[model samples]
Target: MTYYRTYENKEDVVIQFLKTRTDRLLKQFDEGNYQNRYEWYKEIFEEILEQKEITYKILKTPQLCAVALEHFNNFAKVLLPRVYKIEGDSTAMHNRIIYQTGGFVFLMSHWVLDGCRQSPEEMAHLLDGYIHNQ
Candidate 1:
C-alpha cells in the first residue's frame, strides 16, 4: 500500500507534482511513437511547470536558459538509464525514474528559490558535471 503525502511548502508541492507528472510522461513515452512521445512529454512538462508557477519564458532568459536546458537534458539521459538498469520493465523503470527526477528537480528548485545567485549556466555546468561524474 502507498501513502500519499500532503505538502505544505511550495517546494514540496512542486516536487510532488513533478514526481507524479513525470511518471505519467514516462509511461506515455513507453507507449508512444518517437514523435508522439516528444509531444506528450512537452505537454506534460508544460502542465507541471504551470502547477509549479514556473514560466518557460522566464526560464529562457540568458542567465537561466543554460541551466534549464542542461539539467533537463542531462537528467533524462543520466537518470533514466540508471533506473532502466535497475528495473527491467518499462513501467517499473519509469516509476523509479519519477522519484529520482523529482528529487533532483526539487533540490535545484530549492537552490533557485533560496536566492543562490548563481547564473543558470554555472549552475547547469556544476550540476550536470556532478550528476555525470557520479
Candidate 2:
C-alpha cells in the first residue's frame, strides 16, 4: 500500500500514532530484552527537555507535541517500510511505531518528538551512528 501524504492533518495523526506507539514501546523497553535501548532513549528524551513539565511551558510542550506529531506522520513516507507491523494507518502519526519482529528500534522513538528539534532522516542518521557505535 502506498503511503499518501495528508499534509493538512498529518501532525495530529502522527501524534495519535506516536502516543499509542510509545505505550507499547515502553513495555518492550521495560523488559530485559530492550532495556539498553529503552534506557538510552529515555536518557535522550529526559536530557532533551531537562525533565521540564510541559504544562508549565504555557503551550510550548503541547505545541512541541503537536509539532512532533506532524513530524512523525510526514516521516511515515519511508517509515511505513521499516515498521514490522502496522495494525493502523492514518495521516496522524498516533498509531505509527510498533516494535515488531524486525526493523530499527531507534527510528520509532526518534520520531517521538516534543517539537521540531530535528527531522526524521536526521534522527535516523544519528541513530545509525549510535547503533554502530561510531
Candidate 3:
C-alpha cells in the first residue's frame, strides 16, 4: 500500500519490486565466482528456490511477466555467448538468444508455479541439458 501510494498503481509497485529483486540476483551472479555457466545458473536457481513463495507470486502475476522475461533476456545475452560460440549473422544470434531465453523462462515459470518440486541442482542440470542439446 505504501509503495502503491508512492508509485502510480499496484502494477508499478510490482514492476519496481521485481526489478529490484532481479537486479540484486544479476549483481550476485556478476560478483560470484563460478567455473561455468552451469554453476552460475545453479546459484541463481538456488536463490530463487529460497524465495519460492514470493517468486511464485511474481511469476503468476500476468502484468509482471514481461519484466521477468526482460531480466532473463539480459541474463541470457551475457551468459549464452560465453557458454557456446554462436557465430554467423547478428540477427541469427539474436534470435537464438531469444529462443533459448524464452525456453528458460518458460521452464522456470512452470517449475516455480508447480511448487518447485525439483531441487535447484536438478533444475540447473535440466537447464544445462536444454542449453547444450541446442
Best model number under TM-score: 3
Tens-place lDDT digits, model 2, residues 2-101? 2355434645554554556554544444454433443444543443344234322423356655566444445444344433344445544343343221
Worst 10 residues of 2 by lDDT: 96-105
TM-score of each: 0.33, 0.26, 0.76
lDDT of each: 0.51, 0.44, 0.76
What would the per-residue lDDT of candidate 3 be over residues 4-114, giving only the tens digit for each residue? 569986567666766676677567666757777688778778877887887787787777666667766876786566456565548877888999988888898899989
What is the number of backbone collisions in each predicted candidate, taken in the order shown? Answer: 0, 13, 0
Ordering by TM-score? 3, 1, 2
Clashes of 3: 0
TM-score of 3: 0.76
lDDT per residue (tens digit) for residues 95-131 in model 1? 5566556655655566445554554545555545554
lDDT of 2 at 74: 51
- Show where candidate 1 strays beyond 4 Å: 1-5, 33-38, 41-134
Model 1 error, position 8 (Å): 5.0
lDDT comparison, 2 vs 3, better candidate: 3
List the lowest-lDDT window of 10 residues for candidate 1: 51-60
Which residue pairs of candidate 1 clash? none
